[model samples]
Structures are given as C-alpha cells and as structure tokens.
Target: MKIVIISPLWERTPPRKYGGTERIVYALTEGLVKEGHDVTLFATGDSVTSAKLMSVYPRSLYTDGVSWSNAYWPSINISKAIEYSRKIKADIIHSHSQYYGYVFSPLSPIPMLHTHHGTLKSQSIGKEKQATLDYFKKANYISISRSQREPMPYLNWVGNVYNGIDVDSFYFNARKGQYLLWMGRFTPKKGSKEAIIIANKTKRKLILAGKIEKNNRNDYNFYKKEIKPLIDNKNICYVGEVSQGKKVQLYKNALCLLNTIKWDEPFGLIPMEANACGTPVISFAEGALNETIKNGHNGFLIKPNNLNGMIKSLKDIDKIDRLTCRKWVEDKFSVSRMVTDYIKVYQKFVKK
Candidate 1:
C-alpha cells in the first residue's frame, strides 16, 4: 500500500523533544516501512525517518520559532501537506493533525484517514463542526481512545488504535537511578503541580522532565508561582525538554513514572513508554490511564488528585518486575500492533 502520513506542523515527525502526535507518526511510518509497505512521510524538513520524506516546511514551525505568519497561511503547514499527498498519489493519506485535514480530505484524490489526537473541547468543535462533519462523511476517523470518540459521537469512527512507541529504543537500566519521574507538558491539565505536591509529601526525589508551552501564559504563571516555589528542595529537579536518549535514561533510572492528569486525556503515551523502560507508572485513574494501567499489576492507577494514594502507590513500585513491565507493553502497546490495526483500517477504505 502506498501510504502518506501527514504529521502535525506544531512539531517535526519524531520530535526532538516533546510531541506525542509527532512521535506516533514516526512510529507508524517506520512500522509500515519495516512491514515492506511503500510509506511516505509528509512532514517538516527536519524530520528524520526511513520512509520517503516529502517536506512541506523548510523546518519545524515549533523548533525554528517560526510563527504561522512565517508560512504562506501565516503559520499553518496544512496546504503543503495536502499538496504533497496529491502529488504522491497516495493510496491513503493518514493525517495526525487535527482540523487541518478537514480542508484537504474533501478534495483528496484518494481515501484519507484522520486521527484525532487532542482532547477536543466544546468550543473547539463549535468552531469547526460543519467542516469536521463534512470531512468525516467522506473520510474515516481513528480515535486514540474510546473516551475521545464520545465527543463527536456521530462521526464515522474506523477504530481505536492506541499510540505506541518503539519499545527497544526506550530500554534503560532500571537500577541506574533512585527517584520518582514526571514526564509530560507543564500544563495544569497534565497535573504537573500535583505531581510536585505528591513528591513533597512522600519525601521522594522528583525529577520533572517536560516542556512548557510559552504561548500559554496562564500555564507559565502557574508553573512559576506554584511549581517553581516548591523546587527549593534538593530532592526536586526540573530538567527541561529531554532528548530521545535522555528520555529513555530518565524512564529507566526512575523508580516509577508519575502521571496525575486532570482531564480526560485522549491517550497518554508516557505511561506506556515508561512501562517499556521497566518503570511502572503511578497515575491518576482519569482518562486513558484507567484503561492502560492495571492497578497493582503493571502499575497503580489511583483516584484523581489523590496525593496520599499516589504516595502510597509510589512506595509499592518495587512489586512490579522489569520483565513483567516490558511484557505488558508487548502484549498491549507495541508499535507492530499499532501498525497492524492501522493497516486494517486503511485496507477497509482503500479496498472499497
């Protein structure tokens, strides 16, 4: 099958730092290529992948500090991705971006697949409801989680294929370090501040690793006022955006990964990635965490915002074995499985 993957313009495919969608695009593109399929990645020039690269931007709009104004549509790269898809005569175009695919899908030369990544709010849907309905009527939608699909219950949902990672790349020596881990954006929705509170109450060393979206001023202020003031403790370390190598190392060395999300996350990838590295995730039982992590099995999923429950679970992290943790990921969240699921979706539409 000739597949063209349209990556999000906010970050490069296989992002250098933090980008769930970009990372998933990279995994899918590589997984398909490894399966002997013709895969083309329509992403920024900075993306590095085995698939044929069809760059729409000179560099990543996020990494290069380029605004939407810098591009032809001011900062959007959707036009370039759509143009590339048409040029390649893609048998199927799989889009990892959000509403941008709506504009291209209506006139697509072939079947198109759009995977909704973010937790869409009512306001966001209201802004693009007509366009989204029109696009989904002609194209297939892949929801990252079942919970996400409920918002637009009327859309043609092809299936739910959870985002996965290359487990081998995340292999880290679990005994290298002794500290709790928090890896995700510094936004309030992610509950980074709550992670800090739990770490403080537990008297455990907390290593915070993630990027702060400078554009969200309120989030920045919350970090500065709430999270930063507590950073005075020697046990708390705020390591900025981590590289691929650092990410694996952080997950491997840590005793466990902490995810205290407040919202219904579409699909949280950090927990799965941490599990791959032989680290159990101690997360709140909100959103996909409940579906991904089994309480007292691979990891612990406690009540949302329960700092005491989180601290208690963090203490029991030793019960989870490295081999069992790795096995859990293989059984449920391998990139191969993700690829096969998507291939099935593509076959359904393309064969028709």
Candidate 2:
C-alpha cells in the first residue's frame, strides 16, 4: 500500500528532544517501510526517515521558536501533504495533525486515516464538539486509548490503536538510581508543579527534563511562576530538554517516573518509554494512565492531586520490580504491534 503520513509541524519526525506525536509518526512510517509498503513522510526537511520525505518547512517550527498555537504553519504542512497525496494517487493519507489536518481532509484524493495524538476539550458547541468532528466525518479516525474517545464518541469511530514505542532499543537497568524523574513539557495540565510537591514530600531527588517554549506566554510564565522557584539544582534538578540517548539513561536509572497529569490527556508516551527502560511510573489515575498503569505490577496509580497517596506511592516505588515494567511495555506497546494494528485499519479502508 502507498501511504502518506502527515506529521505535526511543531517538531521533526522522531524529534531531536521532547516530542511524542512526531516520534510515533516516525515509528509508524519506518514500520510501514520495513513491511515493504511505499511510505511518504510529510514532515520537516530535517526529518531523517527511510520513507520518501516531503516538507513545507526546512526545519521544525518549534526549533525555529514558532508557537504551537499558530495554525498557519501547520495548515501549510497539511496542504503540502494533501496535495502531494493527491498527485501521487496515494492509497491512504494518514494524518497525525489533530483537528487542523482533518479540516483539510475534504480535499483528500484518497482514503484518509486520522489519529488523535492530543486531548480535546469542550468548545461550547463548535470547535471540539460534534459539529467539528462531523465536518471531517468522511475520514476514518483512530484513538490512542479508549478513554481518549470519551470527549467525542460520536465521531466516525473505527479503531483504538495505542501509541507504541521501540522497546528493544531502550536501555534497561535493574539497579535503580537514587532520584525520581519528571519529564514533559512545562504546562499547568501536565502537573509538573504537583510532581515537585510529591518529590519534596517523599524527600526524593527529582530530575526534570523538558522544554519551556518561550513562544507560549502562559506556559513560559507558568514555568517562571510555579516551576522555577521550586527547582533547586541540588534537590529538584532541571536538566532542560534531553536528547533521546540522555532520556533513555534518565529513564533506566530513575527510581520511578512521576506523571502527575491533571487533565484527561489522549495518551502519554512517557509512561511506556519509562516502563520500556525498566523503570516504573507513579502517575495520577487519569486518562490512559488507568489502562497503562497497573498498581502493584509495574507501577502504582494514585488519585489525581492526592499528594498523600502520591507521596506514599513514591515511597513504595521500589516494591515494583523493574523487570515487570519492561516486560509490560514489550508485550503491549511494541512498535511492531502498533504497525500490525494500523495495517488492519488501513486494510478496512482498502477493501472499501
């Protein structure tokens, strides 16, 4: 099958650091290519991929300090991908650009598959409501988790393929390090501030690795106001955004990954990546974490914002065997499995 993957423009496919959607796009594109399918990845020019590469920008928008909320660049990215797919008479145009990409699906010359990589909130009755999804109902949609579809279950639901990672490449360590890990973008909904409180309460050394996008005023001010003062290099170390190799090292050594997310995020790659590195995750039982985390198995799940539970769980973090964590990810969230599942979704479209 010939497929064109429309990647999020904010970061390069398989991002240099701290990106999830593009990383999955890279994995999917590579997996399909390995399966002997013709794949065209529409991403930044800098994106390195085995598939045929197409791009609207020379480099990732975020690396150039472009704000994620700016829809202009992404629309251009989507247009380029759609136009190319039409020209090539592609079998499927797989989009990972959330709502922005789907809005342009009406112009698609072939079957379009859209995967939701980010969470959606209510927009009264317009933006994220049924009307919005209804506009692009012709496109087949895939959800990363069952819970992620709750906000708009009425959309043309097809399959729920969990986002996956390459488990074999991740470094696994049984001898855990002394510190805890908190990795993600600095946003109020991500609960980075809450992770700090949990680390402090548990008296564990904390390492925070993620980016603070200067273009996003609210997030930049949030880091300054809530996350900055809390980071004391000695106790709460802020290592900033980490490369893939550095992230694997951090994940393998950390006692556990702290994911105190406050929102019902669509899906998070952090927990799966952490588990693949043989490190457990202690996260709030919200969104896909409910399905990802198994208490007393790989990691413990605490009620959202429950400081005491999170602190207590952090103390018992060692009880969870590191091997079990790695095994869980290898079994359920492998990239091979994700590719197979996606093939099934695409086959359905092909039969039509």
Candidate 3:
C-alpha cells in the first residue's frame, strides 16, 4: 500500500527531545516501513527516517525562532504536502495536524485518515472548527485516548490508539534510585509547583528537567515566578532540558516519576515512558492518566490537584514492583502494538 503521513512541522520526526507526538510519527512510519508498506513522510528536511521524506521547509520551524510569529509557515507546509500527496497517487493520507486537515478531507482524492493528537477544548478550536468537524462526520478520525473524545463524539470515530514508546530503548532497572523525577515543560497545567510541594513535604530529593520556552510568556513567567525560586540546587535540582539518552537514564534511575498535571491531558507519554524503564509513576487522576497509570500495578493515581493525596501515595510507591511497571507498558503501550492498531484503522478505509 502507498501511504503518505502528514506530520507536524514544528519539530523533526523522532525529535532529539521533548516531542511526544513527533516520536509517535517516526515510530509509526518506521513500523509501517518494516511491514513493507510504501510510505512517504512529510516532515522537516532534518528528520531522519527510513521511509521516503518530503518537506516544504528546509529545517524545523521552531529552530527558526520565528515560527510562532509567522502563521504562513505551517499554512504552506500542510498545503504543499496535501498537493504532493495527490501527485504521488497515495492510497491513504494520514494526517497528524490537529484540525488543519479537516478542510481538505472534504475533497481529498485519497481516503484521508486524520489523527486528532490534542485536546479538543483549546482556544484555537472555536465554534466554527467544531461545526466544521461535526459537518464532516464521514471523515475517519482517530483519538489518542477515549477521554479525548468527550468534546466532539459526533465525528466518524475510527480508533483510540494510546501513545506508545519503544520499550527496548528505555533500559529497565529493578532497583529504585535516590531522587524523585519531574520532567515536563514548566507550566501551570503541568503542576511543577505542585511537584515541588510534594517533594518538600515528603522530604525527598527532586530533580526537575524540561525546557522552559522563553519565547512563550506564560511558560517563562511561570518558571521565573513560581518554579525558579523554589530550585535551591540542594534539595530541588533543575537540570534544564535533557536529551533523549539522558532522559532514559533519568527514568531508569529515578525512584518514581511525578506527573502532577492539572489539565485533562488527552494522553501523556511521560508516565508510560517512565514505566517502560521499570519506574513507577504517581500521577493525578486526570483525563487519561486514570487509564495510563495502573493503580498498585505500575503506579498510584490520586485525586486531581490533591497534593496531600499525591504526597501520601509517594510513601507506598515501594509496593509497586518495577518489573510489573515494565511489563505494563510492554503489553499495552509498546510501539509495536500502536502500529498494529493503526494498521487496523487504515485497513478499515483502504481496500485490499
């Protein structure tokens, strides 16, 4: 089968770090290629992939430091990718762009399978977009989690494929380490402040690692005001953003991962990534965390925003077998399973 994947232009496929969505794209594309499908990936030129690559931009837009300021970049990226898909005579066009492909699905020559990778309740998704999605009910749409389908369930729901990671890459360690881990962009919704409070209350050494996007006002101010002051370097350490290799090391060594997310995240890859490394995760019971973190099996899930509950759960974190955590991800959230599930979704539309 000839397939064309429309990936996000913000980062390279299989990003060096900090790209959960792009990682999925790269893995899915590789998996499809391994299965012997003729695949073409539309991503930035720098993205390394086994499949044939096509791109409108020479490099990722984020590296330009002006992608946020300019709206024309992505507009042209997606536009040209779709135009090229028809030229290639692709059998299936798989889109990872949130809702930009919704408009094109109406008249697409090839059967377009759109994967909704974000929460549907954002400011960008206005009434007009919602109405447009509702109108295009025949278009096949895939959700990352079942909870993500809450806002717009009327669309032609094809499948719910959870975010997955390459388990073999994340080396496992049965023995827990000294410091607790919190890795994510510093934001109010991500709960860095809450994680600090838990670390302080529990009297455990905490390591905070993730990028602080200085260009974004909300993230920058939140880091300086709320998160930075708390980083004393003695009890709490802020080890900027880590590369993928270092991230795996941190996951393997940390006593446990803290995912104190305040928002109803459609699906979080951090917890599953940690679990793949034989590390337990203590997360708030928000959105898909309830499904991602298996209670008493891989990690514990407390009530949302309940710092006290999270702190208390930390005490029982030892009860969780690290091997069980690894197995949970291997059985349910491995990249192989994700690719197979996606192939099933594609087969529903593509004829043999």
Candidate 4:
C-alpha cells in the first residue's frame, strides 16, 4: 500500500532530541518501508527517513528558531502535504499533525487516518473543542492509549494503538546503575519537582534529562525555581536534553526510570524506551503508565503524586527482573508489532 505520513513541523521526523510524535512517525514510516510498502514522509527538510521524503519548510520551525506562532507553520506544512497527497494519489494519508488533518480530510479523495498523539483534553478546548465536536466524526482517529479515549468516547475512533519503539536502538543492561532517572519536559505537570523530592527522600542519586525551551517562560521559570536550586553535582545531576547515544546510556544504566506525572499523559514514551534498555520504571499510575508498566512484574505503578510510595518502590526495584522489562517491550512495543497493527488499520481504509 502507498502511505503518506503527515508529521508536525515543530521537529524533524525521529527528532534530533525531544519529539515523541516525530519519533513515532519516523519509526512507523521505516517499519512500513521495511515491510515492502511504498511510504512517503511529509516532514521538515531536516528530517531523515528510509521512505520518500517531502517537505515544505527548509528546516524545522522550532529548530530554526522561527518566531511565528505555533499554529502558522503547521497550517502551511499540512497544506503542502495535502497537495502532495493529491498529486501522488496516495492509498492512505496517516496524519500525526494532531488537528490539522480534521480540517483537510474533506478535501482529500483518499481515506485519512489520524493518530491522536496527545490527550484529547490537551488538544480540544474552547473553540477547538467545538470544532472537533463538529468535524471529528469525518476523520478516522486512533488513540495512543485506552485512557486517552475515555474523555471523548463519542469521537469516531478506529482503535487504540500503543506507541512502540525500535528495541534494537536501545542497549539492554541487566546490571543496573546507582542513580535514578527522570526524563521528560521540565514542567509541573510532568512532576519533575516531585521526582527531586523522591530522590532526596530516598537518598538516591538522581539524573534529570530533558529539554527546557528557552522561549517558554513556564518551562524556564519552573526549571529555575523548582529544579536548578535543588541540583547538587554529586547527588542531583541535571543533564540537559540528551542525544540518542546519551539517552541509551542513561536508560541502560539507571536504577529505575521515575515518572511521577501529575496529568493524565496521553502516552509516556520514556517508560517504554527505558524498558527497551532492560531498565524498570517506577511510575505514578496515570494515563498510559498503568497499561504500560506491569505492577510487581517489570515495574511498579504507584498512585499519582505519592512520594512515599515512589520512595518505597525504589527499595523493591531489585525484585523486578531487568530481563523481563526487555522481554515485555520486545513482545508488546516493538516497531514490528506497531507496524503490523497499523497495517490492519490501513487495510480498513484502503481498497485492495
């Protein structure tokens, strides 16, 4: 089948540093290509892919430091993608551009598949919510997790496909390291402040790795006020956004990945990446963490924001086998499995 993947313009596909949706798009694009399907990736010019590449912008808007509002570039990128889709007569257009697909789906002759990479509440609100209420039924939607669809069950959903990773990209380490790991944006909702508290209470070394956008005041203020002051080089180390190599090393060596999220995250990608590296996760049970992390098996899922439970789980982390964590990801969250599931979805729309 011929497929065109529409990606967000903020980051390159399989992003250089921090882009979960782009990474997924790249993985799925490559996975489909490897399966002998014709795949075209509609992303920034900076994006590298095994499939045919199409782009409107010379580089990613965020990486290039474009000062325009977030909505502006995506609108242009989506228009370019739609124009390309019509020219190619694509069998299916799988969109990762969030809401842009809903607006353009009516214009395309081919069937479109939209994957909701973020939470419904995060995407839909006020005018956008009303817009979604009016037009969401026209496009086929796929949820990243079952919990993500609970809020808007009335929408036309094809199925829930959990985000998957290329397991081979990660190095599995059976022997764990001394420090705890916290990876995500430095935001209050991600519970970075709470991770610091848990690490301090448990007397464990903590390594925090994530991007703090300089332009975003909320990210900068939170990092300065809640995160920077607490960082001591010896115990609490704050490593800024990591590359793929550094990320693998951090995941493979950490004692356990800490995900003390306050929000119902659509789907946390860090935990799955950690699992692929044979590392266990001790995450708060919110969003997809409950579905991803098996309690007392690969890792423990504590109640959200429960510092005591997270601290306690650190002691019992050794009981969870590192190999089991690797095995779980290989079975459930591999790129091959994700591609197969997506092909089933594509078949539903494509006339064979």
Badly placed stretches (over 4 Å) of model 2 are: 123-131
For candidate 1, the TM-score is: 0.91
Residue-level lDDT of model 1, residues 150-241, one tens digit each, is 66777778878988778888884546357888988888878888888888788889999999776567877878887888776478889888
Return the TM-score for each candidate structure.
0.91, 0.96, 0.96, 0.96
Error of 1 at 14 (Å): 1.4
**Backbone clashes, candidate 2:** 0
lDDT of each: 0.80, 0.87, 0.87, 0.87
Worst 10 residues of 1 by lDDT: 67-76
Count the clashes in each prediction: 3, 0, 0, 0
Off by over 4 Å in 4: 67-69, 122-130
RMSD in Å for all candidates: 2.6, 1.7, 1.7, 1.7
> Which residue pairs of candidate 4 clash?
none
- When summed lDDT is taken over every stretch of 10 residues in candidate 4, the lowest stretch is 122-131
In model 2, where is the ten-residue run with the lowest total lDDT? 121-130
